[model samples]
Target: MKKLLSMLCALLTAIGLPGCDYVNVKELQPGVSTAVEVRQRFGPPQHEWRNEEGSVTWEYSRQPEGAECYMITIGRDQVLQSIEQVINEQTFARVERGMTPEQVRRMLGRPASSQYFQLKQETVWEWLMERGSTLNDPTYFTVSFNPEGRVVGTGRYTKLRP
Candidate 1:
Protein backbone atom coordinates (compact mmCIF):
# COMPACT_ATOMS: atom_id res chain seq x y z
CA MET A 1 0.00 0.00 0.00
CA LYS A 2 2.82 2.44 0.80
CA LYS A 3 4.53 1.79 -2.52
CA LEU A 4 1.32 2.32 -4.40
CA LEU A 5 0.70 5.62 -2.62
CA SER A 6 4.24 6.83 -3.42
CA MET A 7 3.75 6.06 -7.10
CA LEU A 8 0.42 7.84 -7.12
CA CYS A 9 1.93 10.95 -5.56
CA ALA A 10 4.73 11.07 -8.09
CA LEU A 11 2.32 10.68 -10.96
CA LEU A 12 0.09 13.42 -9.67
CA THR A 13 2.99 15.83 -9.27
CA ALA A 14 4.29 15.17 -12.76
CA ILE A 15 0.92 15.63 -14.35
CA GLY A 16 0.08 18.74 -12.30
CA LEU A 17 3.28 20.60 -13.16
CA PRO A 18 4.19 19.73 -16.69
CA GLY A 19 6.55 22.68 -17.22
CA CYS A 20 8.45 22.47 -13.96
CA ASP A 21 11.10 20.06 -15.15
CA TYR A 22 14.56 20.58 -13.77
CA VAL A 23 17.12 22.53 -15.80
CA ASN A 24 20.45 22.21 -14.08
CA VAL A 25 22.39 25.34 -14.91
CA LYS A 26 25.42 24.07 -13.06
CA GLU A 27 25.89 21.40 -15.72
CA LEU A 28 27.19 24.10 -18.07
CA GLN A 29 30.78 24.98 -17.30
CA PRO A 30 31.81 28.01 -19.31
CA GLY A 31 35.42 28.19 -20.52
CA VAL A 32 35.93 24.53 -19.59
CA SER A 33 33.45 22.54 -21.67
CA THR A 34 33.50 21.87 -25.42
CA ALA A 35 30.84 22.34 -28.08
CA VAL A 36 30.51 18.62 -28.61
CA GLU A 37 29.81 18.02 -24.95
CA VAL A 38 27.16 20.72 -24.94
CA ARG A 39 25.44 19.18 -27.92
CA GLN A 40 25.64 15.71 -26.46
CA ARG A 41 24.00 16.80 -23.24
CA PHE A 42 21.43 19.27 -24.54
CA GLY A 43 20.65 17.80 -27.94
CA PRO A 44 20.80 19.92 -31.11
CA PRO A 45 20.88 23.67 -30.85
CA GLN A 46 17.74 25.41 -32.06
CA HIS A 47 19.69 28.36 -33.44
CA GLU A 48 23.31 29.10 -34.34
CA TRP A 49 25.30 32.24 -35.04
CA ARG A 50 28.66 32.90 -36.65
CA ASN A 51 30.30 36.20 -35.85
CA GLU A 52 32.79 38.13 -37.98
CA GLU A 53 35.50 37.30 -35.45
CA GLY A 54 34.92 33.60 -36.30
CA SER A 55 33.34 32.72 -32.97
CA VAL A 56 30.09 30.79 -32.93
CA THR A 57 27.03 30.88 -30.65
CA TRP A 58 24.42 28.20 -30.15
CA GLU A 59 21.03 28.57 -28.48
CA TYR A 60 18.91 25.86 -26.90
CA SER A 61 15.43 26.69 -25.69
CA ARG A 62 12.52 25.16 -23.79
CA GLN A 63 9.60 27.40 -23.00
CA PRO A 64 5.98 27.53 -21.73
CA GLU A 65 6.12 23.85 -21.03
CA GLY A 66 9.73 23.73 -19.82
CA ALA A 67 12.13 25.35 -17.40
CA GLU A 68 14.49 27.68 -19.29
CA CYS A 69 16.16 28.61 -22.59
CA TYR A 70 19.82 29.45 -22.68
CA MET A 71 22.71 30.22 -25.05
CA ILE A 72 26.15 28.77 -25.05
CA THR A 73 28.74 30.80 -26.90
CA ILE A 74 31.66 28.83 -28.28
CA GLY A 75 34.84 30.50 -29.37
CA ARG A 76 36.70 29.86 -32.58
CA ASP A 77 38.82 27.42 -30.60
CA GLN A 78 35.59 25.42 -29.96
CA VAL A 79 35.63 26.04 -26.22
CA LEU A 80 32.54 27.30 -24.49
CA GLN A 81 32.87 30.98 -23.54
CA SER A 82 29.55 31.80 -21.89
CA ILE A 83 26.31 30.20 -20.81
CA GLU A 84 23.56 32.76 -20.49
CA GLN A 85 19.81 32.54 -19.96
CA VAL A 86 17.81 34.49 -22.55
CA ILE A 87 14.22 33.97 -21.45
CA ASN A 88 12.89 37.07 -19.76
CA GLU A 89 11.03 40.32 -20.23
CA GLN A 90 14.09 42.44 -20.93
CA THR A 91 15.08 40.12 -23.71
CA PHE A 92 11.65 40.19 -25.27
CA ALA A 93 11.62 43.98 -25.22
CA ARG A 94 14.80 44.06 -27.26
CA VAL A 95 13.21 42.34 -30.22
CA GLU A 96 12.40 44.87 -32.94
CA ARG A 97 11.76 45.03 -36.65
CA GLY A 98 14.87 44.92 -38.90
CA MET A 99 16.92 42.92 -36.38
CA THR A 100 18.76 39.91 -37.70
CA PRO A 101 17.92 36.43 -36.49
CA GLU A 102 21.36 36.25 -34.92
CA GLN A 103 20.73 39.42 -32.93
CA VAL A 104 17.34 38.24 -31.75
CA ARG A 105 18.62 34.80 -30.91
CA ARG A 106 21.33 36.36 -28.77
CA MET A 107 18.67 38.06 -26.69
CA LEU A 108 15.83 35.51 -26.62
CA GLY A 109 17.68 32.23 -27.08
CA ARG A 110 15.84 29.82 -29.39
CA PRO A 111 12.13 30.23 -29.87
CA ALA A 112 9.75 27.51 -28.67
CA SER A 113 8.83 26.79 -32.30
CA SER A 114 8.79 28.29 -35.77
CA GLN A 115 6.80 28.15 -38.97
CA TYR A 116 7.84 28.94 -42.54
CA PHE A 117 5.47 30.28 -45.14
CA GLN A 118 6.75 29.61 -48.62
CA LEU A 119 4.26 31.69 -50.56
CA LYS A 120 4.73 34.69 -48.27
CA GLN A 121 8.47 34.18 -48.07
CA GLU A 122 8.46 34.61 -44.34
CA THR A 123 9.18 32.69 -41.16
CA VAL A 124 7.42 33.12 -37.83
CA TRP A 125 9.18 32.25 -34.61
CA GLU A 126 7.17 31.95 -31.42
CA TRP A 127 8.08 32.03 -27.74
CA LEU A 128 5.61 30.92 -25.08
CA MET A 129 5.80 33.05 -21.97
CA GLU A 130 3.65 33.38 -18.85
CA ARG A 131 2.56 36.99 -19.04
CA GLY A 132 -1.17 36.61 -19.04
CA SER A 133 -3.58 36.77 -16.10
CA THR A 134 -4.40 33.07 -16.07
CA LEU A 135 -1.78 30.77 -14.61
CA ASN A 136 -2.28 27.84 -16.93
CA ASP A 137 -2.66 29.87 -20.12
CA PRO A 138 0.46 31.46 -21.63
CA THR A 139 1.00 34.17 -24.19
CA TYR A 140 3.03 33.96 -27.36
CA PHE A 141 5.63 36.45 -28.45
CA THR A 142 6.01 36.08 -32.20
CA VAL A 143 8.52 37.58 -34.60
CA SER A 144 8.18 37.42 -38.35
CA PHE A 145 11.39 37.14 -40.31
CA ASN A 146 11.81 37.82 -43.99
CA PRO A 147 13.40 35.48 -46.51
CA GLU A 148 16.75 37.06 -45.78
CA GLY A 149 16.38 36.19 -42.09
CA ARG A 150 15.71 39.67 -40.85
CA VAL A 151 12.91 40.56 -38.48
CA VAL A 152 10.02 42.04 -40.45
CA GLY A 153 7.49 42.41 -37.65
CA THR A 154 6.36 41.11 -34.25
CA GLY A 155 3.19 40.38 -32.27
CA ARG A 156 1.74 38.98 -29.05
CA TYR A 157 -1.14 36.59 -28.60
CA THR A 158 -2.76 35.07 -25.51
CA LYS A 159 -3.95 31.52 -25.25
CA LEU A 160 -7.67 31.06 -24.81
CA ARG A 161 -8.83 28.90 -21.95
CA PRO A 162 -12.24 27.34 -21.33
Candidate 2:
Protein backbone atom coordinates (compact mmCIF):
# COMPACT_ATOMS: atom_id res chain seq x y z
CA MET A 1 0.00 0.00 0.00
CA LYS A 2 2.81 2.40 0.82
CA LYS A 3 4.47 1.72 -2.52
CA LEU A 4 1.21 2.41 -4.34
CA LEU A 5 0.79 5.70 -2.48
CA SER A 6 4.31 6.79 -3.43
CA MET A 7 3.68 5.91 -7.04
CA LEU A 8 0.43 7.88 -7.06
CA CYS A 9 2.17 10.91 -5.62
CA ALA A 10 4.89 10.74 -8.21
CA LEU A 11 2.37 10.44 -11.02
CA LEU A 12 0.40 13.41 -9.81
CA THR A 13 3.52 15.53 -9.64
CA ALA A 14 4.61 14.48 -13.12
CA ILE A 15 1.24 15.09 -14.72
CA GLY A 16 1.15 18.73 -13.66
CA LEU A 17 -2.40 18.47 -12.43
CA PRO A 18 -4.30 21.74 -12.28
CA GLY A 19 -2.40 22.54 -15.44
CA CYS A 20 -3.06 25.66 -17.50
CA ASP A 21 -6.04 27.94 -16.94
CA TYR A 22 -5.80 30.15 -20.02
CA VAL A 23 -8.53 31.91 -21.95
CA ASN A 24 -8.45 35.27 -23.68
CA VAL A 25 -9.98 37.13 -26.60
CA LYS A 26 -6.92 38.62 -28.30
CA GLU A 27 -6.01 35.06 -29.08
CA LEU A 28 -8.45 35.71 -31.88
CA GLN A 29 -6.59 36.33 -35.11
CA PRO A 30 -6.37 39.74 -36.76
CA GLY A 31 -7.95 40.93 -40.05
CA VAL A 32 -11.05 39.10 -38.89
CA SER A 33 -12.48 41.22 -36.10
CA THR A 34 -12.29 44.80 -34.85
CA ALA A 35 -11.33 46.21 -31.46
CA VAL A 36 -14.87 46.83 -30.32
CA GLU A 37 -15.67 43.20 -31.00
CA VAL A 38 -12.68 42.01 -29.00
CA ARG A 39 -13.59 44.18 -26.02
CA GLN A 40 -17.04 42.67 -26.02
CA ARG A 41 -15.71 39.13 -26.06
CA PHE A 42 -13.15 39.14 -23.21
CA GLY A 43 -14.76 41.92 -21.19
CA PRO A 44 -11.88 44.38 -20.83
CA PRO A 45 -8.50 42.66 -20.95
CA GLN A 46 -6.18 42.12 -17.98
CA HIS A 47 -3.83 44.79 -19.36
CA GLU A 48 -4.29 47.61 -21.85
CA TRP A 49 -2.10 50.38 -23.21
CA ARG A 50 -2.70 53.37 -25.42
CA ASN A 51 -0.28 55.53 -27.33
CA GLU A 52 -0.32 59.33 -27.40
CA GLU A 53 -1.89 59.15 -30.83
CA GLY A 54 -4.70 56.96 -29.39
CA SER A 55 -3.53 53.65 -30.78
CA VAL A 56 -4.29 50.84 -28.35
CA THR A 57 -2.42 47.68 -27.45
CA TRP A 58 -3.59 44.79 -25.32
CA GLU A 59 -1.61 41.87 -23.98
CA TYR A 60 -2.79 38.56 -22.59
CA SER A 61 -0.64 35.76 -21.25
CA ARG A 62 -0.92 32.40 -19.50
CA GLN A 63 1.89 30.46 -17.84
CA PRO A 64 1.31 26.76 -18.19
CA GLU A 65 3.05 24.10 -16.20
CA GLY A 66 6.84 23.74 -16.46
CA ALA A 67 7.02 27.51 -16.80
CA GLU A 68 5.77 27.45 -20.35
CA CYS A 69 3.76 30.46 -21.53
CA TYR A 70 1.30 31.54 -24.20
CA MET A 71 0.94 35.22 -25.06
CA ILE A 72 -1.20 37.13 -27.52
CA THR A 73 -1.25 40.78 -28.54
CA ILE A 74 -3.99 42.92 -30.05
CA GLY A 75 -3.59 46.25 -31.75
CA ARG A 76 -5.58 49.47 -31.24
CA ASP A 77 -8.22 48.59 -33.77
CA GLN A 78 -8.94 45.42 -31.84
CA VAL A 79 -7.11 43.24 -34.33
CA LEU A 80 -5.06 40.27 -33.23
CA GLN A 81 -1.66 41.11 -34.61
CA SER A 82 0.67 38.86 -32.62
CA ILE A 83 0.83 35.65 -30.59
CA GLU A 84 3.56 33.82 -28.72
CA GLN A 85 3.35 30.31 -27.27
CA VAL A 86 6.48 28.76 -25.86
CA ILE A 87 6.87 25.19 -24.65
CA ASN A 88 10.40 24.31 -23.75
CA GLU A 89 11.66 20.84 -24.66
CA GLN A 90 10.54 19.55 -21.27
CA THR A 91 7.04 21.01 -21.39
CA PHE A 92 6.78 19.84 -24.98
CA ALA A 93 7.40 16.29 -23.77
CA ARG A 94 4.66 16.43 -21.12
CA VAL A 95 1.67 17.38 -23.26
CA GLU A 96 -0.94 14.64 -23.00
CA ARG A 97 -4.07 16.60 -23.62
CA GLY A 98 -5.72 16.80 -27.12
CA MET A 99 -4.11 14.19 -29.37
CA THR A 100 -1.03 12.31 -28.13
CA PRO A 101 1.86 14.60 -27.21
CA GLU A 102 4.13 12.88 -29.65
CA GLN A 103 1.84 13.77 -32.53
CA VAL A 104 1.85 17.41 -31.49
CA ARG A 105 5.63 17.39 -31.31
CA ARG A 106 5.91 15.94 -34.79
CA MET A 107 3.66 18.61 -36.26
CA LEU A 108 5.74 21.34 -34.69
CA GLY A 109 8.96 19.95 -36.11
CA ARG A 110 7.97 19.37 -39.73
CA PRO A 111 5.72 22.31 -40.44
CA ALA A 112 4.63 22.74 -44.07
CA SER A 113 3.42 26.37 -43.94
CA SER A 114 -0.21 25.29 -43.46
CA GLN A 115 -1.98 22.23 -42.07
CA TYR A 116 -5.55 21.89 -40.90
CA PHE A 117 -7.24 19.06 -39.07
CA GLN A 118 -10.37 18.27 -37.13
CA LEU A 119 -10.53 15.64 -34.44
CA LYS A 120 -11.52 15.77 -30.78
CA GLN A 121 -10.42 19.37 -31.53
CA GLU A 122 -9.78 21.46 -34.59
CA THR A 123 -6.30 22.83 -35.31
CA VAL A 124 -4.76 25.02 -38.01
CA TRP A 125 -0.99 25.27 -37.91
CA GLU A 126 1.13 27.83 -39.72
CA TRP A 127 4.44 29.73 -39.55
CA LEU A 128 4.83 33.54 -39.65
CA MET A 129 6.90 36.39 -38.27
CA GLU A 130 5.91 38.01 -34.97
CA ARG A 131 6.08 41.71 -34.19
CA GLY A 132 8.64 43.13 -31.73
CA SER A 133 11.55 40.98 -30.48
CA THR A 134 14.96 41.46 -32.08
CA LEU A 135 16.47 39.26 -34.78
CA ASN A 136 18.25 37.11 -32.22
CA ASP A 137 15.23 34.90 -31.49
CA PRO A 138 14.27 32.13 -33.87
CA THR A 139 11.01 32.38 -35.76
CA TYR A 140 8.05 30.76 -34.02
CA PHE A 141 5.10 29.06 -35.57
CA THR A 142 1.75 28.71 -33.88
CA VAL A 143 -0.81 25.93 -34.10
CA SER A 144 -4.17 27.19 -32.89
CA PHE A 145 -7.31 25.09 -32.59
CA ASN A 146 -10.88 25.59 -31.66
CA PRO A 147 -12.93 23.75 -29.04
CA GLU A 148 -15.36 21.35 -30.81
CA GLY A 149 -12.37 19.55 -32.37
CA ARG A 150 -12.18 21.80 -35.42
CA VAL A 151 -9.13 23.75 -36.50
CA VAL A 152 -10.37 27.26 -37.19
CA GLY A 153 -7.05 29.03 -37.74
CA THR A 154 -3.24 28.84 -38.10
CA GLY A 155 -0.41 31.39 -38.13
CA ARG A 156 3.38 31.92 -37.94
CA TYR A 157 5.65 34.75 -36.79
CA THR A 158 9.36 34.93 -37.59
CA LYS A 159 11.77 37.12 -35.72
CA LEU A 160 13.94 39.31 -37.89
CA ARG A 161 17.53 38.19 -38.23
CA PRO A 162 20.15 40.80 -37.50
Instruction: Specify the highest-TM-score model's number.
Output: 1
* RMSD value for candidate 2: 19.3
Native-referenced Cα lDDT, model 2: 0.43
- Residues 53-99, model 1: lDDT tens digits: 98887766666465367777889888889877666677778888899
TM of each candidate vs. truth: 0.60, 0.27
lDDT of 2 by residue, 1-162 (tens): 755644454354344331312323223456776665445433444445454655555533222112223333566555666544534444334333455323553323323244445563555544332323444544454555565543333334654565
Give each prediction's root-mean-square deviation over alpha carbons: 7.1, 19.3
Off by over 4 Å in 1: 1-23, 63-67, 100-110, 113-124, 131-134, 144-155
**How many Å off is the CA of 115 in candidate 1?**
6.8
